[model samples]
Target: MLKKLINIVVFVPLGVLLIILSVANRQTVTLALNPFEPSDSLLSVSAPFFVFLFLAVILGLVLGAAATWFTQAKYRRRARSEASEAVKWHREAEKQRSQAEKLATQASLPAPQG
Candidate 1:
């Protein structure tokens, strides 16, 4: 619940701002680009407004993934190292316990009196 509220608070204003800017700059912003040059044939392929928006979204996703990978790489290495150390310690503990049990058995055996 808290997460949803925070997202709304953060993104709602940003979305509204984008809408406002889009409306204000509609004339200045080119919604489509002609694939053919001015000297080329009359046939021209043009992209729509949504195409630009889609490209922007894809670019943001790529950048976000790159940033996350870079930041978490070190932590992933550290976690693996800690897990290996834990396994080493656990094996040593088991060895020590087995040795202690063997010693206890030896001590309990009847001894020849002098």
Candidate 2:
């Protein structure tokens, strides 16, 4: 239910905005690749303004996500180790519990006479 609401509120608006941008920015513009010579037409490419806008946005998002992942690498490693430690402790506890139950049952039974 929340997902639907989010789609309606966030995604729908964003999609409409992108569509409008694309339509409004349909004009072709030259993009220079080299920094040394900005006027070099041979090293430039022509594309729609919307294409550059979307590409820059996507590139920024990818770089930002990659930086975030790298920054949190230590946290991710710590969480993974903690998870394994928790599992080990849980198994050890279960084993001890079973052993205790077995001993309890044995103590409850009557001894056999020779």
Candidate 3:
């Protein structure tokens, strides 16, 4: 519920602002040059103004995902190493505690001090 409220609060004004901007600048034209040549002659997507916006959004999403995955890879590796080291330490501690208990029992069995 709170998340939905926050989303509405954040995106509602953003949507309104975009609508206002689109209305105000509805007559403007922007052009982008495609670096790669199309192989098919009939499938040339060269001229529409909205195509640039679409390509920009797609590129942004791909770059964002790549950046997120790249940044998190190191942290994931570190977390795995830390978890394994913690398990190893726990086992070593348990072994040492058991040995200490055995030594204590043996010492209390009335052995003569030399």
Best candidate (score: lDDT): 2
**TM-score of decoy 1:** 0.54
Question: Model 1, range 1-114, lDDT digits (tens) per residue?
Answer: 999999999999988977875565444334324455543434543454555665798899999999999999999999999999999999999999999999999999999789
> Highest TM-score, which number?
2
How far is 14's C-alpha from truth in model 3 (Å)?
A: 3.9
Alpha-carbon runs more than 4 Å astray in model 1: 8-45, 111-114
Q: Give every collision pair in model 1.
A: none
- Please estimate how well model 1 matches the true structure, expressed as its whole-model Cα lDDT: 0.78
- The CA lDDT of each predicted structure is 0.78, 0.97, 0.77
Tens digits of per-residue lDDT for model 2 on 37-106? Answer: 9899899999999999999999999999999999999999999999999999999999999999999999
**TM-score of each candidate?**
0.54, 0.82, 0.52
lDDT of 3 by residue, 6-77 (tens): 999999998897667555554535342344654554544454444456567789999999999999999999
- List RMSD in Å for every model shown: 5.3, 2.1, 5.8
